[model samples]
Target chain A: MAVVVMGDVVQLLQRQPGEEGPISDALLLAALANGDGNALAELYLRHHLKVYRFLARMAPLDQSHLDDMVQNTFLAVRQGAHRFKGNASVQSWLLAVAANILKQHIRKESRRRAIAAALTEIPLETTTDETPEARLARQNSMRLLGKRLHGMSHKLKTVFIMCDLEGISGSEVAAVLNLRQGTVWRRLHDARKQLRVALAEYMEVDT
Target chain B: MTRCPGKEQLTRAISNDSSAELDAHLMECPVCRDECEKTRKLIEMAKGLPDGHPTSQTVTRIADELRATRPERDLWASARPGYGVVLVAFLLVGAAVFAWNYVFYPPSGPSGSANTNAERRDSPKGNVTASRSAIYTHSIEHKGYAFDEVVSLREGTVTIQVTPLKSNERFMVKTDDATVEVRGTVFTVVATNGRLVKVSVKSGKVHVRPKHADVAILTAGGQWRRRTHPIQKPTAVLPHSPDSGVFPIASPEAASHLTKKTDRLDRTDKTVPAPMKKKETVFQEGWSLLRKKRYAEAANVFDNAVSSSNGKDLNEEIYFWRAAAHYKSNQSEKTGEALTDFMRRYPQSPRMDEARMMYGWHLFNTGRYETAKQEFESVRQSPLPHVRQNAGLGLRRIEARQ
Candidate 1:
């Protein structure tokens, strides 16, 4: 009897760390289909924090609005559970949903803010103890960094977050954002170059 | 010897997998090295910014919401492995009930073999059995009527004080002679020897019928008599003067009318002996038993009273109480039979009106919708104002469902 190599391809896609050897995604789906609420809860618990963090970074943290986005993400997961084909990891599917929820939240907030000024004012504050010269230098550095990051294109910002902040591999970022791996690499390179030009003075002062 | 890398090539060169050729080019090229170092610092700076983790409360809130929103069946299934056992036990109990009804107490047809002797004895009478002892009597004074109580006419005569007469209220008084229908009034109908039915209206008016005779209306102070021959035209005057041994009355016509009506009837017909005072006590004991919800025992007691009375009127209250007992025990068929028998034997009874109302409801609950509708319609059209109103409501409900 010969085992097909296609089985390995399927296994490679679904492999997760800390999981017992390789439980089939089909078995997890079967448990869910049997009206297993605990299985659904366990699936949610595993990825909800990361999903929330992704949305919070993407959208302004209006406590109430963020809460609604979080709720909507899980609700979509629940309703879309049947459609899950085990092609991708559950974490990727959930992150996709969270991204959509964040996008929706941004659109809604923009419309709402257009009609009225935001009702909740976020209190901003400084959190460092420093001498006057140090404070001035820190302020200049922060301003330069913010101006550069803000000036970068949306594509570059996304690449920077995915590759640098989130520490996801360029390939995984391509998978998550549905971009080509080469495209992701190109965007990160462009963003870093733009930042270097903007922060040239800061780098000179630090040296 | 060196070449400066483009920004894209420089970014790729920082990767551990980049070839030594790319690294060698980067070390020799200051412009490329400076560009790569700045890109590295910028990347580090972006990573150093807040990671944007959710607060603990937010995580807790989301978890709670997920838990609360989870379907109830899922929680039960996950928590308990014993639900299958509980469900099976429930099904077993339901099956047992179904088995008991279909196998042990199968429904009987009109004249089926399943009919018990007691049921046979309770069947409608083919001929009116004349008995001196079994007279059922019911009387209502200022207080209205309770349909379940039997009226006893055994004390030679009983003065039934029908009071607070509401217009159109119908009362059926059954005597050996005929059934008397009263439309609101205080009246006394004395049954002597269970053969003579003499009616005297103290107030209001009463319509009297001697078994097969046309109804005759007797007004206040009016008297009517039923003898062996037939009821003579109602004489306006009293039959005996106040000087004669009877209650003294200011209206001589009324007093004489009552005396004459009582005297004309033959006393020779055997009177079903009046229930002994002790036996009456036992009848009351049975009634108390019914009130206590001891239906089976109460029915037995009522049976004893009826049988002891030689099947005569058998205190109407006894049968009424018996019906109630059967109803309490969920023996709806038996209760229906008892109520029907009560109606047949005491058609003109004061309690008949109430019994019919209750029986209508009982029939409705038992799914005898057509029969219940008929009963309700009858009461709705009844001359009694309260009965008409009650029956109208019941009819409306029945019609609404239909």
Candidate 2:
């Protein structure tokens, strides 16, 4: 843990244990809570891509408010750093925060529909050049994926994304979501069922 | 007696979270085992999905946002009432007490400072009277300010004197409609008409702002009048003003010229009973009213003068005075039009630079940004140092916004 003195901030007390050579993620977070700018810069370098990936997967074509969502998530990290329990890994905690921010964002039903519709209309920007047939197939699959993913309830969506996409174990997700492992497994099952049906329909249309 | 293992049991086994019972159930049923294999493949596809990343601009923006919110952290921590709260509360109470004492118990004499009373003191006898013509005099000290306002509240040509203790101190003799703000000065503010206050700065400068009107500064040897009531009856002069020789309403110099002409009229036309003013006389009267700050009355006179002088020279003075009257009345559109006409008609006027700055400021205030920038830019190249400095500052302000 490292301490930084700031005006009106009496003292910074380290909570997370420190390490040698390279700072652990938990130690970096503790330093950030203590107002360490260097710790924040390092954490940003490590986690910005993962946070952005989470947002883009959720709201694919909503480029307009994606920056705001990402910024708000990190802002919460700085403000709520003292409350970080470090029970789960820091990556799981960051994903949890990003998910919570996203939940609050799509709480408005109209905005959720608008973003989903927009995502369906615009093809994802592929890294390589895309042929007409490949582009259409890619766009159709992406639309079905986005629709099927968000169509699940937030509980199932969180469990599904954490377990399947991010490679977080069901136990880690259960810890992050404050749920039992059995409940996390049940939600993950429901999400997989809905997604399989959507994928079956999508594959049939393609054939 | 067991049925097929469900999709949930298949998910449990595929994600490696299987209990002994779930594994046995999945292994015993062929359909449940096949479902578990498809679920594993779906999870594998999700793990191999292409990543979507943020641009570098976005990362910097998030860091900047966190930095901006850093200031709110201290406030959030101390939002509750704590140790320093008592000291802050005590200081506020002390400030309130000091304010109360300063307003009601202002000191007497030159050490006293002025506070804006809730209601205007009608006569000096409401508090302090120094024997000569209901005089209201006080000394007040506030925030280390000391001053005296010797206000004579009697009728008929009573001169008021003020002694300002500091350079920034203000003393005023307030009337019903106008507040006469002065520093160390000697001035006479007469109730010229039932609804007008005539301020004659005998020795020093005074700033007089009428009720709901902008301030107008008058220097020594300058004379101006403002209306004391909203409903003013257009009268020539105060009835109580006995010394008509120095009366500002109709200047003695102007009267002399009119008298010399009247003498000629009497010689030429003996039957003329009423000395009716010619159109030239009417225009001169409007110009005289404008110089005296009787703008509403002057505007009417200027309008008549402009209509009559259409066939004649329509002197440059008419345009300038008309614009001045319009500006004082807060008619910005008319003022803009009039000033534009004046600048075109009299490009070589001595007051052109100051007038250009006025027009630019007017344009800026009205949100005509591009035209205002052009105006300020052209004025920034003026030979006059002060004008150039002012225009340069204006351009900088506009540029900062841009």
Specify the highest-TM-score model's number.
Answer: 2
Candidate 2: tens digits of C-alpha lDDT, residues B1-402:
257666556676787767888777777777777777777765654544444566778777767656545423755554666757877989999988787656544533333545343211221211222334433334332333333343434333446665443443456666555567777677776653322246677777887766655567778877765422222222232222112311122222323332222212111111223454565466567756755768778877776777766626665556666665666555678779877977988787644664576566567657777888888887777765655766776677677768
TM-score of chain B of each: 0.30, 0.29
Fnat, 2 decimals, each candidate: 0.34, 0.36
Docking class of 1: incorrect
Q: Each model's TM-score?
A: 0.36, 0.41
lDDT of 1 by residue, B281-371 (tens): 7666775665465767877777677678765745565676566556555677887888888888778765566567667767777777789
User: A57-79, model 2: which lDDT tens digit per residue?
Assistant: 65553655777777777777777
lDDT of each: 0.57, 0.63
Model 1 spans with C-alpha error above 4 angstroms: A1-37, A78-96, A109-130, A143-154, B14-17, B67-402
lDDT: which candidate is best?
2
